[model samples]
Target: MTITQKIKSLPLTFLLLFFTAVNIFGQKPNIVLIISDDHACQAISAYGSRLTQTPNIDRLAKEGAIFNNAYVTNSLCGPSRASILTGTYSNINGFKDNISYNFDFNQPSFVKALQAAGYQTAWIGKMHLGDSIPQGLDYYNILPGQGQYYNPDFIRSGNVQKRYTGYVTNIIEALSNEWLDHRDRQKPFCLIIGHKATHRVWMPDLEDLGSFDDKTFDLPHDFYDDYATRKAAAVQDMTIAKTMRMGHDLKMYDPADSATFEDNIKRMNADQKAKWFAYYAKIKKDLDAKRPEGRALTEWKYQRYLKDYLATAASMDRNIGKTLDYLDKNGLSKNTIVIYMSDQGFYMGEHGWFDKRFMYEESFRTPMVMRYPGVIKPGTAINDFIMNIDLAPTLIEAGKGQAPAPVQGRSFLPLLKNQHYTARDAMYYHYYENGEHSVSPHFGIRTKRYKLIRFYKRVESWELFDLQKDPHELHNIYDEPGSKPVIADLKAKLLKLITAYKDTEAAAIFARAI
Candidate 1:
């Protein structure tokens, strides 16, 4: 029989069920995915932050689900973003590191799937995909590179560059709202708003310059780690004590260097420049008077770094609130699926490090929260193992489309419904960036209780941590007498995963480590 004839002949109860299924499956939800660069989970109050509070970000957790164990396939910026876009690992996507590569926008992505399925897609803010514009996007306005703190330049849809005249975070938020204003209301849309806040050389809005001045941040317990057992950790150069520069990172550039401060204030109009200099003059005066030395100097710089970082984060959180408020006031909250995440985890002075390249907990685990009013229960939290690669599959599933065969990620929709759902036995991570921060290229497997890493290339070494015993990863027990069986099992699993994922290059490298 024809579908129309069958529907007309069906009994009332049967007809209701048939139409209900169609309504439920046919009505795709609008998606708003907000990603910020180098934002550590520990920095968000929703994730139990100790440094600062993020009320707007916390709102997503209160209204939806929070994933506590979300990680990235690779911890660096470009690699992690590539993994998200392609739903595959860095090796599979072909953008393994932060330099000398362009993302092949021709690759099949979840965005393309959504577009094909009749959804309007838009990308705004710091995509960091590559030098060129990404394909499969209907509209986009992105920063040229890492992006500047104040008055950054953005490349719009036609490769036209426009310089915005405000704090980067605020400008990104405003542009997102503008895009939403002009978007077609009839079709379901997928919008990604990427913020450049909380990245390197953190710069706060002028109004937030002294926001954290009264509060003192406590140093991490392992701030003075000697790296006694791990040679890989000992030889790295990301430590804040020695590597964080005063001129570039901490904003203590010489006053006589007219160009340094001028570049920051150039984009500001008269009133804006006046306000900026007024706020900065006080900080410069304090530094000049103190002239802190020795451990005191390092501690002073740490405090300065934390203050600016948290202030920048505060501005980002405010913009998040603005976006959420827009959805609520416009009556788009019920059918829209809102998500807040970071490209990857960042180091927040944990282990006395300020950059993110290692396989440590701070850099490897990212923050993820989602709000889908009817489908997801409010105030829910899940501890399942999830990765950035899983995002593409999840979005595709949410949009009522199937993930393509080439995609390596699995959808976490089941876990959202039932937190105890078994997803994967372990997660894999590989960092291929060589010597940018003096960190060795490495690959590892992280199970529920153990983490095994092989730091190769410049150094052939192994490190194993029993997370149940040492959450801080202070001691590497790779050479401990009783660890032979555990190490053997992890190594076998690692090899199997490497081969299964078609990471042929990594497999060859793993053979040498074994």
Candidate 2:
């Protein structure tokens, strides 16, 4: 009750507080980064999409933090990945878009960073960052960018070239299992498990081809956005009506569709030409006898799309379960930090579009789930804005190490543990659409209530929407005089963000003009 009595208990009280904090935040948990290509958050069951079946992805959210507001700096494949790797934006890393260019892996990555921090690093499956896989990535079976879903060629460490005969998911899983079985167990491991699933021209294994044959997929509400105001949306290379390639995706060029073999052969050249003709010959012969009709036809394509995407994901989910089982079987789950995420969200018939590039809600949001054994209390949903670049700094900070220099993203370690933590006021987003495809360039910033977008080039326009009122982003508020003041404020913040992220193009142009 006296001052001396309180002073005598101070050391014990301090020791108890320190121990409690330490127990809540584990020291150096093994990090497992599971990234999927173009796997939209809408596809995962955890995000409340009832269409697809993804139990493993659901389990991660059930066990740890589910980041509802997770986003990517760049919505495309390569640039977003560059942001993920370096914890910086596309302009800073020089991988602004996906073109004939490749990402320079020589730069600092989370793999090299964790490896430096005494963790054994391995990258399995798709590393669509660039062709050249850097040296210190412990084990690699990466497919440069958008590797084949069937019979993919895997490049092992010993310069051995081997053609994997099974589906890509199966191959990736097998290789990852091998790496796990043989990896140095004494040290903490950082395994980067990437899946080349649910990308364009979706292909499925023969066994899974008839899985979703009976289900009729519900079309999205905005499946037919006329693009009258959003002209840039009309010029995309992935329009469902015509732009989606028939031969590659729609199966319109199958030999059965064409009466003669020569007509089928017209689209092919050399080996790829012959291979497609042969595959088409078999399927064509089957179709000629009895063409699929009415509900059968609808079911056929549904099966094609469903099995094609889900089969790949099925293998991935199984393999993820394998990894989790390994951690548990080996008594490592208690000390492991597992994260499952996608490069960016993809269109599942939304806006009648495919691929990721446009700054829509589906493409803009990515699936991000983290399970840090002792640190992150399970089932915490963080509604604040989080992005791709933040993953690295968060990992470094969680490992009881100081965050390195040149990280554009801030760590959300506080939000992970503290339920009452306040995160960023606004999340900045910018995606350049001039790449191999003719997707128009654009940039934007999103707040909880308002969104500001600026389309590039001739007669550039600004789009402002109060997201609270227009959650679907169907109506443009930028033109309305009532939203003008709000637009000005968000635009100023967007410009400030461009400067903060070292967006060189915006800097030079805006500075000289303003």
State TM-scores per candidate. 0.93, 0.85
What's the lDDT of the predicted structure labeled candidate 2? 0.73
For 72-113, candidate 2 gives per-residue lDDT tens digits of 988987888788878888877778777656788777766667
Off by over 4 Å in 2: 1-27, 252-307, 419-422, 435-437, 509-514
* CA lDDT, every model vs. true structure: 0.87, 0.73
Residue pairs of candidate 1 with colliding backbone atoms: none
Error of 1 at 140 (Å): 0.5
Per-candidate alpha-carbon RMSD to the true structure: 3.9, 6.0
lDDT of 1 by residue, 1-514 (tens): 9988977988999989777667644589899999998999989999999899999999999999899999999898878888888899988899988886788998899899888878999988898878866887899999987888788999989899999888999999899999999999888999999899889878898878889999988988888788988877888998888999876777664445554555654566777766755776678789999888987887887888899899989999999999999999987887889999998888777888888888899999999999987779999997889999999998998888767888999888777766455678899999988878789889999999999999987667999999999999998999999999999999999999998889998888888734
Clashes of 1: 0
The pairs that clash in candidate 2 are none
What lDDT score is found at residue 357 in candidate 1? 82
Judged by lDDT against the true structure, how good is candidate 1? 0.87
